[model samples]
Target: MLYQSFSGDAEVGTSIFTMNGGSLTAAIGPLFYITNTDSIIELKDADLTAMSGTLLTASADRWGNNGSNGGVVTLKAENETLDGSITCDSISSVTVMLQNSTVLEGSMNAENTAGSMA
Candidate 1:
């Protein structure tokens, strides 16, 4: 049970986070709060659960900075289990891919604007 947060406060326009063979339960979150235009989260042979709110969230800043807000996010789960929902802003997009016995126990939302695709 590790307590941590992965924020998209990097200089790169694209933020990618990958993990394999483990269990990740949100201490408190959307688990992933990303503001990058291109955000990718990949989990293989792992477990991700969210007890409240959402599992992954994509949009503008957590702050009031809506300058470069909204983009596309790709979530890849292979031979894993996911237990939560996903949220994509009205101007953003969220794409989910499940493969090889991957299980999704929740819903997802994708806004899919002109600049983005779900």
Candidate 2:
């Protein structure tokens, strides 16, 4: 499957996107964009290869716009392979956890934030 642009605003306790057990290719745009507090994108047990794009969190105007606090963006994956670039903005709380034989074959760029990759 090929995705051109993936962006949305999800409510709390809800996920914006989720993928499991397949091959996904993203074109020349953002793979995922989280624009609300506690929004999540769960990619578990899948093979995703991105050419050139980002998994950005929040827009410039909406940065830190989640109730005066950074929104929560979670990327949880297990046994997956990701290729290309992913970015998390400064005003968002992003968590990325890849475990159990997962491989990342490109750049993961986070701006003014920290996340776990294990």
Candidate 3:
């Protein structure tokens, strides 16, 4: 299933939509109001559940400066059954490893925080 919209309006089949010299490439579905001054979108392995709106700009890549939002960025699984919770800009670092691993259950609102485990 590519996309089955209830009302949000995205159902793209025979998927090859590209706009070079300005940059846009979509295969699957669901992209609305991508008001691009400079844009890049890539999805390799995806089964992402949900995300609601309100991001009024400033999301530069190269692993730097990930801030400004109205809350909701989620990546559910990485390297098998990874659980979640990551709230940046308030400053947070959480890393969980194998064999019955859990971290930062609740109430860690950071001004400056650091954590390490192996």
Task: Kindly indicate the candidate among 1 and 3 with the higher lDDT.
Answer: 1
The Cα error of candidate 1 at residue 80, in Å, is 1.3
Expressed as tens digits, the lDDT of each residue in 1-118 for candidate 1 is: 1111235443545667899987777778777766635777888987676768577777765433365566567888899777777776666677888889998776676333334434
Per residue, candidate 3 scores C-alpha lDDT tens digits across 44-86 of 2333221222111112222223332111122112222211222
> Which pairs clash in the backbone of model 1?
none
Among all windows of 10 consecutive residues in model 2, the one with the lowest summed lDDT is 1-10
Instruction: Compute the lDDT of residue 9 as modeled in candidate 2.
Output: 43
lDDT of 2 by residue, 1-118 (tens): 1111224442335456777787776676666555434655668777665555554444333444444444456677788776655555555455677778876665665343433221
The residue pairs that clash in candidate 2, if any, are none
Candidate closer to the true structure by TM-score (higher is better), 1 or 2: 1
Instruction: Tell me each candidate's TM-score.
Output: 0.75, 0.63, 0.17
Model 2 residue 55 lDDT score: 43
Report the C-alpha displacement of residue 70, candidate 1, in angstroms: 1.9
Best by lDDT: 1
RMSD of 3: 15.1
